[model samples]
Target: AQTVTQSQPEMSVQEAETVTLSCTYDTSENNYYLFWYKQPPSRQMILVIRQEAYKQQNATENRFSVNFQKAAKSFSLKISDSQLGDTAMYFCAFMKHAGNNNDMRFGAGTRLTVKP
Candidate 1:
């Protein structure tokens, strides 16, 4: 069975600062994708960043980035220059290499609060 785990239940970051959230997963498949999704008060899930298992380089998008360690099965999200708008429930997700039936699994989530 595949599973994702977010050790932190909540996190806080000052404006313009940086924060890193931890995530780990268990999976047997070698080929897959890892993602970090942020859900705001509106309840919309936004893709923060994604990392491919085959790619050795970590993924980055502006202030959002991911530290993907395939061997350790760890994928952590780093938010730089955090802003108030960044406050949201962040989730780590995993999806195996499937044709159409992509069974994506997510972690419990980490609620991040950005303080001014």
Candidate 2:
């Protein structure tokens, strides 16, 4: 069974600063995908970034990026030039590339508060 762990239950970042959220996972499958999903106050889960296990380069999207350490099974998200709108509950998710029933496992999530 695969599981994602987000050690931080809550995080705060000042506007215009950078914040990194820690995430670690346990999995034996060699081929899989890791994702960072952001759920704002509206409760919409937005795909922040995704990393393929086989890819050496990390995934990035605009002000969002991920530090993917496949060997250690560590995938963390970094938010640059954070804004108040970035505040949300962020979840780390995992799914096998094989797409078995399109099943995906999500972490408990970390509540991020962006302060002005």
Best prediction by lDDT:
1
For candidate 1, give the lDDT of residue 102.
81
* lDDT (C-alpha) at residue 76 in model 2: 96
Q: For candidate 1, write residues 1-116 as lDDT tens digits.
A: 99999999999999999999999999999999999999999999999999999999999999999999999999999999999999999999999988878889999999999999
- How close is each model in CA RMSD to the real structure? 0.6, 1.0
TM-score of each: 0.98, 0.96
Error of 1 at 88 (Å): 0.4
**Candidate 1 TM-score, true structure as reference:** 0.98
Task: Score each candidate by Cα lDDT.
Answer: 0.96, 0.93
Error of 1 at 111 (Å): 0.3
Candidate 2 per-residue lDDT, tens place, 31-109, comes to 8889999999999899989988999999999999999999899999999999999999999999886655655899999
Largest TM-score belongs to which candidate?
Answer: 1
What number of clashing residue pairs does each candidate have, in the order they appear?
A: 0, 0
